[model samples]
Target chain A: MATPVYSGAARTPQRGRPRDASRDDALRQAALEVMAEVGYRALTMDAVAARARAGKATIYRRWESKLDLVIDTCTQLAQQNLTEPDTGSLAGDLREFLSAFAAFLSGPIGKAAQALVGELPHEPELASAFRETFLTAQRGVLRRILERAEERGELRQDAPRGMAVEIAGAALIYRLMLTGDPLDLPFVDRVVDQVLVPLVAKGQ
Target chain B: MATPVYSGAARTPQRGRPRDASRDDALRQAALEVMAEVGYRALTMDAVAARARAGKATIYRRWESKLDLVIDTCTQLAQQNLTEPDTGSLAGDLREFLSAFAAFLSGPIGKAAQALVGELPHEPELASAFRETFLTAQRGVLRRILERAEERGELRQDAPRGMAVEIAGAALIYRLMLTGDPLDLPFVDRVVDQVLVPLVAKGQ
Candidate 1:
């Protein structure tokens, strides 16, 4: 399994002429587009290279394989403008978080993710990369939000943060993948109001 | 896409000596074994026929395609014996349910399910069959249990039964598929006590 190189931990910044930032952006975008169009199974390094108009060596220079590239692309795509919404209460934060999450899942990333889950078992390296790059990062965001709620006495201390996040996130994915249901705003609100808030809310 | 054949909802039971029940059982078992050895993607009608020591036509006679065979096999295998544990409370029923669910997800069914999820997006027929056979049936069991709890004045009137079931089931699957974590008894208990019970329990 290819371990994630870009942990949030401080790394000594590479001391050299910076690689072409625009080229990197282009390659990542190309990768996401290909993944969205054809699933992870059919996505190939050569196609990404062709789409990005870059040499295979250029992609290989950064990522070890297609899995690595796909993982990195998904991570980049996922990190677009995550703002923690504060509605002055846990209910407010949950609503915003769930709503944003539903939007993303309905968008390109979600489609790609639904495609990736099945492939994970067969491709351990890709699975590890996905866990490290996307799952861990997303969990971190949810954890921070939950921590804020906890500090405000909105969430019960006894509630398990990890389990809560999994339930909230997985509910959305299950609906999308199994039921072919749209994760609309009303659905998100209902999930937050009726499911998550009550489970984690501090007082009875 | 193979359309499910239903000879009307009220088809009279065929009045004949029950056709080779043991043969049907053997074929289903054979399908599961092949799925475990090779994944769902690699599993084929020819392979299943060879493994079961039956002709391809014989297997196809019962099931229209690999999807039908596999879906039927999964449905048979996932026949969970969920006896409602009456520890005199909702928490007890939830705990028992979670424990049993976690055990199944950790077993062969979990591996098959992971493979199925991967296949679901690309194969619409298989996805639809999976929903009707396994996912829907499982949800029904959980729903009935929750409804029983609600009737006993143990649950909120507007508690999201479907959402709660999805979350509970997905938490187990997410851990197994993404994290490679063991779904031990304590984990099940935590999910029940912390997530499920609270979400459904009566009163704020």
Candidate 2:
């Protein structure tokens, strides 16, 4: 399995000029488009470069292999615009977090994610990248929300906090990958009001 | 793209003698082993037949194609030994249902199911089979549990019944596929006591 190198996290000394953010975004977007069209199996550097209107050498310069490129794209997809919201109340915080999550599930990132699910078991590097980036970030968001609720004295002290993250992550991902249901606000509200509220709220 | 042929559900008239139950089980088990070893993309009927110590002709007499065989294997894996339990109380029912589900996730079927997750997006017929067979059956089990709770007056009438099932299914599958955590009785108890119990209890 290949070790994925995030742009800034590489141990090697930084080269001359810093990589362009816009160029990286365009490359990742191109990779996502090609992945959504042909899936992870058929994706290639040439195809991604052609789609991005860049030379193939440009892709190799950043990512060591196709696996490296896909992992980076997945990491970017999960981390882009992901920030913990400070919505005062537990319900408010949950609503903000889940709404953003639902948006991710309803867009191109979600489609690309669907194609990656089957590959996880076969690809150790990809699986670890997913856990380190997407899964960890998701848990971190929910954990902060619960922490704020705890500080506000709005959550039960004995609440199973880890399970709370598991439920939220599972419900959304399951719907996206397995059920093929619409990941809309109504569904997000169902997760928030129906489950998260009852499970975490200090008093019912 | 081939439609899966479940026994006794085939549109074509009964052909000759009824298929042997033991024979079918062997083939499905063989398919699962090969899938777990090589994944869905590389799985072939020849490998399955060779593993089962059966001729290719015997395999074809049942499944029309490789997709057909894999789908049937998935359906069988999910449906095997799955039955609704009447544990009477809501929490008891949930514990039993989740324990059985946890058991499935901890076994060989779980490994095979993991590989199938990625293929679902690319294969329409397989996706529908999953929804109709596995997903529907999962919902049906939870629905019956909730209905029984309603009869016993243990559940809130306005409770979000569907989200309960989604949470149960999602949490377990997410843990198995993404987190690579242990799906034990302790985990099952956490789901029951923490989320499902609070989410569904009438007066919680």
Candidate 3:
């Protein structure tokens, strides 16, 4: 079993009180706009504060650093936009998951992720938390969906092969991060049918 | 078909005589050392020149910017390390290719790539050339190997599915770039046997 390395060192908590919902919304929207405009390297907390019309102290109370702010903005976006659909079968469950996944990748959070990715290697805390806070949350959704389909006997006994489970997600990430390609509905369908469906479906 | 978009904008060739082989080797090696030491963002052309004991002109004459130099060093490393294996079976060929791929990812060039990936989206010219110069070259090798497998009846005629052709490479990349997981031979073997072999083998 590949032990999940959920390192806690990365998620350095904010020093002040928890963020209010509307304030949080304004700050994150500002973060995304700044990220898209300036790219990650040039993106600064001051600029985000300026853009959002929030005081610098308000931004700091929520996030410790620019890296934290960006990561939080993305995390908030994921929680807001992400949902798992139960379509009664493994294929449909996955199609629903991927459709939502593709849309997420095309939206604001996805753009933030792309911009922030280059900094991941240099920032250990950000990298670890990103996997746990963001990527793991998404994977957990997929895992539950797969488990349900298996219970219904719609999938192979050895379905959701450990690392192979990542093929769809990994391929999608590869297209976005490395290859600089677009992710769309048709691309999602092909991965599900050609790769995931063929590999995991029962009595194929 | 995805048209090959090879814009000449990124690779602004130097207006100079051909670089000497030994000097080029020293500069590239120095680039790797500086990258490993300071990472991509901090790496500078002046630093590379100082480290390699070469003039700043020598470095600039060869590369337009630090991004160009880094990409070129990675490209050269890929050409040097990349090789095709006639392993006679799709499984064997994939195994051989992945082993080499794993080894490369664990090496100096791999380290450089890890360091540079975060900057891809911000650097359009570098991103485009990276797809063309580094990634496309590797994929071509895999494609030829797969085509041979299909010809020998070892694979389904449409064996290497369109997007799924990326599963192996993408999985490996996702592990490295996103998840911060190690890409070892055993990891490589599981993806081949479980995900890839099952997905494409004839009579599955």
Candidate 4:
């Protein structure tokens, strides 16, 4: 059997004074930095420890393995600007979501997210953690936004909000991953105006 | 420098007893099979040669490196279906394109494609070749279909065909790569009928 390369539950929780929470933040940030700089394949626990100015024990105290640390860092990075906007209109809310989502993709988190996706098939646990922590959270935000829109009678009666969320977010990610293009304001504008607004508009 | 793994350019141009092209085909198929079984990181050229019952010289003669062989094989596997229907309308054409595209993603190429994307960052040359061969070809297909739609007055005159194509294909790829979903027919139908067609239709 292929050995388990990573697992979140493998870490033994510390019983003493809670370790420096600040160090946790620094380590997570360091993980993202190293991943972006060297790619996921080259990232190592030692590198993350050195970059964060923390001992290897500190990292191990929190994450069971490098994959665990990477997943946590990705989760934290994705959550940085995940607040949902309530502009009272589906267009406004979706525009904000897409804009923030685009910024995240083009920002540090984007690099980490791409690296994580690249690592998924090789590391099944990392893949599962990524879905639960990052993708599922982001999808939740989009679902809530769409649910509000649907309640307001903004979407077609037969429209699937979950699929809508998938389409919107997937469109942006596809560009980032496959095209290797910068996510610009104009592209965001086009996605919102052309795709989101019309799909959610009451009448066809 | 890393030792080259493939041998596509080394063979002499001989007329008598042309090298068995069938052996080359067998090796490529075997490579993909091993990749699906053990993944890209653990795959070996010797294993491929053994699987094909061909000498290592035969394998190296056709590909200069493992990356080269893998990329060529992926291109061959991916090139199976590129047909786009006229259908007399943009929606119909897009629906057809997406359906066929989904089929490829769920088929043999899908697993190899995922493996390749996972391996790209570790191998930039392979990534570049993948983009040039597979991604560029697929994008061209979508572009041609969209361009024809615009010419037929089905798409908005001001609509960005490039962005539209990106969104359509990206949405599908994103779900496949991140969500691990099946990219089912109903999802494709909803995206085509709800998200794509209305977005590209003329007039707000």
Query: Highest TM-score: which candidate?
Result: 2
After superposing candidate 4 on the true structure, give the runs of residues whose Cα lies further than 4 Å from its correct spot. A1-16, A37-47, A50-53, A65-67, A150-156, B1-19, B37-47, B86-89, B147-153, B201-204
Q: How does chain B of model 3 score on TM-score?
A: 0.86
Q: Fraction of true inter-chain Cα contacts (below 8 Å) kept per model?
A: 0.68, 0.84, 0.75, 0.58
* Residue B169 error, candidate 4, Å: 1.6
Q: Give the Cα lDDT of each candidate.
A: 0.71, 0.78, 0.75, 0.72
**Candidate 1 global CA lDDT score:** 0.71
Give the TM-score (vs. native) of candidate 3.
0.88
Top candidate on DockQ is: 2
Ranked by DockQ from best down, the candidates are: 2, 3, 1, 4
Q: Per-residue CA lDDT of candidate 2, range A21-88, in tens? A: 79988999999999888878788999999999999988888887887788777666665645467868
**Candidate 3 segments whose C-alpha is farther than 4 A from its true place:** A1-19, A37-43, A64-68, B1-19, B36-43, B64-68
Candidates' RMSD to native: 5.7, 5.3, 5.3, 7.5
iRMSD, model 1, in Å: 1.7
Model 1, A30-136: lDDT tens per residue? 88778766778789889999999999988877676787677766765565534456666777777777787788778766667777776787678778777777777
Worst 10 residues of 1 chain B by lDDT: B2-11
| Candidate 4, TM-score of its B chain | 0.83
Please say which candidate is ahead in TM-score: 2 or 3.
Answer: 2
Docking class of 4: acceptable
Candidate 2 stretches greater than 4 Å from native: A1-14, B1-14
- Over B58-105, each residue of candidate 1 has an lDDT whose tens digit, in order, gives 887677778777876776555532343445567876777678768877
- What part of the reference interface contacts, as a 0 to 1 fraction, does candidate 3 reproduce? 0.75
Greater TM-score among 3 and 4 belongs to 3
Clashes of 2: 1
TM-score of chain A of each: 0.84, 0.89, 0.85, 0.86
Q: Itemize residue pairs with steric clashes in candidate 3.
A: A118-B118
